[model samples]
Target: MLEQSTRSERGSMTGEEARRAVREGRLSCQTSSLAPGYVQGNLVVLPQDIAGDFLRFCQRNPKPCPIIGMTEPGDPHIPDLGVDLDLRTDLPGYRVWRDGELVEEPGDLLSHWRDDLVGFVIGCSFSFEEALLADGLEVRNVAEGVNVSMFRTSIPCAPAGPFAGPVVVTMRPFSPADAIRAIQITSRFPSVHGAPIHIGQPEQIGIRDLSKPDYGDPVAIRDGELPVFWACGVTPQAVIAAARPPFAITHAPGAMLVTDLKNSRLSIL
Candidate 1:
């Protein structure tokens, strides 16, 4: 009975249930472990001056940076996200960058709000993770209670003026059978980084060590479990940090924006 209680406490909520919790301030933390079968997004807010170029960057590189929904310049609402969604405060956490350097990490984007900033929602690994879980495969980060580790690879992005940098990927270690299931499950969600780019060879992508990642926390790779890579939405944040635009905003790593759209809606077929 005690073990049952513990398991129930650790159990996650459904997508719509969690979204309502977030709106009510009951669940104001990482959305990763919140909604088991919903879509969560990585966010990027930039000046109208650079948004056009950035759009092209996403266009050129859809795998690592799929655009889920975008807002008009200076607008705070993305109707597709939610009816009451306010870009300034709906999220749990935000990262503010000034002149290309990270300057502040806030609970909301209200103070940093500007008339020229535009919001872009990128399809996140949460979609793919849901697919994996549905196939009865374990996601190590979800199992271990940590952010999925992200790495910057030697691979270059198709340069778009000042927005060019190496592609970044998130790693998850799975057994061979689970890994194959992950590949097939994720392949259906093309908008959210479909399938594995490189599996089992971390060093080939300039990732020197599994324990040391550029961002997020590392998880164990059990015996016979191989590490798999997927094009990550975090790639844009890395690029923005390197490009150093005068001002930028991003969803804090792992604290993604939960949209009204369902994960199933993102599946290409």
Candidate 2:
């Protein structure tokens, strides 16, 4: 367990340290702005039988469902992502679903673990945020201490078997000029949802209100700032729910699996 005195330094914690705190029950909160430079992932666990279709679904929708790492059937660790990363407890939170209905949000998956389950770690947009901040752009959620605003959009993802749903997106308000720069900056991290899919008007993408986001918290938009949308990793949560698999588990939105991999490693340029 992390010492109580180290709590204030959580923002600077290494990926392994952060995971240690989370696994030890010392921390339980949305992990946005934590462990900067480490790649964070959205978690999805499913029965081994249906893992193939879900993998194809990710392949078909690379922007929102990029595969960063995965575990073998019944395995709880992803060595490439983190040497000691445990799917059962590294994340701050977990969402358990059954028959398309959310059953519980647990702190750990110890009770739900099964011998036939498979885990997938999807790349998170939060990983590319370091590049945005390094370039001097304000990441509203980080600045405001909140999870990035996410919403379901009208844009449909290419379906693969039972996995299919409208694309979910994360929004950040920025000036017209900054939006373009954000696009250029984010375009380098293709594995972590590269580039904005839409800018300015949210309604064109089926988002009716900026204040009321479907997942995570909404940030304030400035006078000249426009709402920029990026395809989000949370899309799989929606897809899994709509598919109504008998059993499935995902990281709670905003609560991600912090991995040992660095953000710089994912950059194409």
Candidate 3:
């Protein structure tokens, strides 16, 4: 569990400062509340042999796999994202997958790096959560100091090559009025998942219970609050698992890559 004190301290960090802390092993917690105004991303590393196919998968399903930054095979630096970014040691945590099975969750990928590896950074809801919070909408997970609840849905993502799976979603609860405001606020940031995909019905998306989520922590829904679901970056990990790629690496849920890009820059409006 992340200490609320830690969250509060890191919450005010600049994107570069946060990444440096992660790189230096000073911090290894979820990026959810860290680097407040910057874009935090989902990391996906794959061998060049499968990178093209995965790229197509992201293209086919933009809502869940919006590409914010990508690196050439074997190259660790995406200069556009940060002047001194080092993919091998940047993210708070990473899950290694082999044959679609998660084998290990490592803090860094130094031993796992290879000449054939390619890196991708997908936009995460953390970006738009900043927008919603700025608009005074309560974000339960953030307020409760836990990961946003995420679930696998009956809805399917458009398949591309070997990547195909259920569309994964992150959930937040709000009153009807705030839900509408959240919709309007989030719509401005399409790259980070623009709007709620499903509202008021968990069973419709194959989610049996709001108390039990497939990923992240579950938060309480007060009376009169409705659960809202949005496409999540975890969809790529789900696809990677289903496809059983020979090898893959992705950020652990909520433990994202804090990039230098500001969240406001990703807003469409």
lDDT-sorted candidate list, best first = 2, 3, 1
Q: What ranges in model 2 sit over 4 Å off? A: 1-5
The RMSD of every model to the true structure, in order and in angstroms, is: 3.8, 2.0, 2.3
TM-scores of the models, in the order given = 0.89, 0.92, 0.92
lDDT of 2 by residue, 176-207 (tens): 99999999999999999999899988999999
Please provide, for model 3 over 220-240, each residue's C-alpha lDDT reduced to its tens digit, 9 standing for 90 to 100: 999999999999998998888
Best by lDDT: 2
Poorest lDDT segment (10 consecutive residues) of candidate 3: 1-10
Of candidates 3 and 2, the better by lDDT? 2
Candidate 1 yields a Cα-based lDDT of 0.83
What's the lDDT for all of these models? 0.83, 0.90, 0.89
Off by over 4 Å in 3: 1-9
> Any runs in candidate 1 off by more than 4 Å, and if so which?
1-26
Q: Clashes in model 3: which pairs?
A: 100-244
